[model samples]
Target: MTIPVKNTMDKKQAITAAIVVPLIICAAASVYFFVGSLEEEHEDNQTIVIVTIVPQQEFVEKVGGDKVRITVMVPPGASPHTYEPTPGIMKEVTKAEMYAKVGSGVEFENNLMEKIISNNRNMNIVDCSEGITKMGNDPHIWNSPVNAKIMVENICNGLVKIDPDNADYYTQNKDNYLEELDTLDKYIHHKLDGFSNRVFMTYHPSFGYFAKEYNLTQLAVEYGGKEPTPQVIQDSIDESTRYNLRYVFVAPQFAAEPCKTIARAIGGETASMDPLARNYTSNMKQIADSLALEFEE
Candidate 1:
């Protein structure tokens, strides 16, 4: 061994190379598998959608379940009538695969539709209010559960078109949600049944569709998108008194002063109601509960 030092060193080098080469190859294989799995998981993530308002987002969630991510243009407690999307929100819209539009002449939708389409020309724009009958350009179609079912159907169709592979999944979810809507409708009917007063007063006329569905009358303080004049307010107060309205429904999105004044004039309390809440089913139920107060003995 002392006479062949160079040979001994060469043999050791050869052993080291043999060991290191296999280790490198094994490490490379592991890294490749890990990266592939990460890519697959990325692909499995939910599809992104852009909706006009919170209620539309709720509808999408009910129909799409965890398979979709929603970005709403009008946040909770914000009025869709005058919502303006920021630059960052527009950027978000560009990345979305679909836009679930209220599509019934919502002022926000009317103002931003062109820009929204331009941001993502390939994006599928689905009108959730497609089949509903309009109430003189009233865009609050989702206020009615029956109309909400139609919207969900439109949403499901849009989802199926975008992701045909998950058609069955989306369909099943839509069916389940529709059934829930039906149950909600029945519950609302039962709650409002046998009420002495079928009329309710609100500062904003967000419940036209709901009132129509339940065979009730909605008297609004604000008409034609303008604040009522003093005379008009007095007339509304007189009407409220005549109808024996117990509550003046005030939306959180608007100033409560007018509602409060009307409530004071009529000797009634102002109750808060949010038409733009993300919890669609619960909001509808709450509206029923509020209206039911008028009929209570």
Candidate 2:
């Protein structure tokens, strides 16, 4: 006699199978989460170390690649000139193996800063301007390509000191970064060379050094000491009209009222330029390209 073959999933058995399937999915998800966490822990433990004293942290990141962890002492949109380090910031710096000292000129007093750094005997402070030719009281050295290369060199040296095992990698990255900066500088020069007159007006004197380096002229409405008096403002207006100025460049944080006033009086338009960005290569290139366009027309 042939045995009867039954297709036999009852309602109770089908319900159990559905429930078990969901439980298995949940179990797998839990396992995956735990494995991912372990991998993240390994990566964290393997990361190289770094700290930046200023917002020029971008430079450190570029040079350090995946090896360094950098911190910016000052936050974005805050003026570094008046940024006083808190107790917490000081504590962090004391613990760091290196500090990026982009603070020079009017931003802070060197003597006081020296005392602070001296107290952190374990920390080596690398002035980003090391081997750089400075232009003015504007501590925004990272704004220029030539100065940016110097900053990259300082960063590489700091990295080697912190993680000597990665010295070759850091050096290679530093050289590559410098080469790119050189190319940017040359490209900017080529673009600006076509302009007949490089004179312009600005609300702040932040670009004094930048202008000096590129053979551009800037007459400022604001100086480090004080704002121009009413008579001076009138004179500035007259000068702008006399020179037939076409561009009035203002900084990101400055009030547009003053620039607008000057622009209206001179029959010119306005442009915004920033000198404090850490990504100097791109920022400088933008400024150079924009200025070239403004002047050429």
Q: What is candidate 2's lDDT per residue for 1-297, written digit by digit as tens?
A: 233322244656788989999999999999999999998876665433333333367678777888766666665555555566667766665656677777456455353466557657777677777777766466656666777677788878877887889899888888877788889889888888778878878777777666777888878887763656777778878878876787778876567677777888888878887776556677788889778866775
Show where candidate 2 strays beyond 4 Å.
1-55, 85-95, 106-121, 225-228
lDDT of each: 0.89, 0.71
Relative to the true structure, candidate 1 reaches a TM of: 0.86
lDDT of 1 at 261: 88
For every model in order, what is the number of clashing pairs? Answer: 0, 0
Clashing pairs in 2: none
User: What's model 1's overall lDDT?
Assistant: 0.89
Output candidate 1 Cα RMSD: 5.9
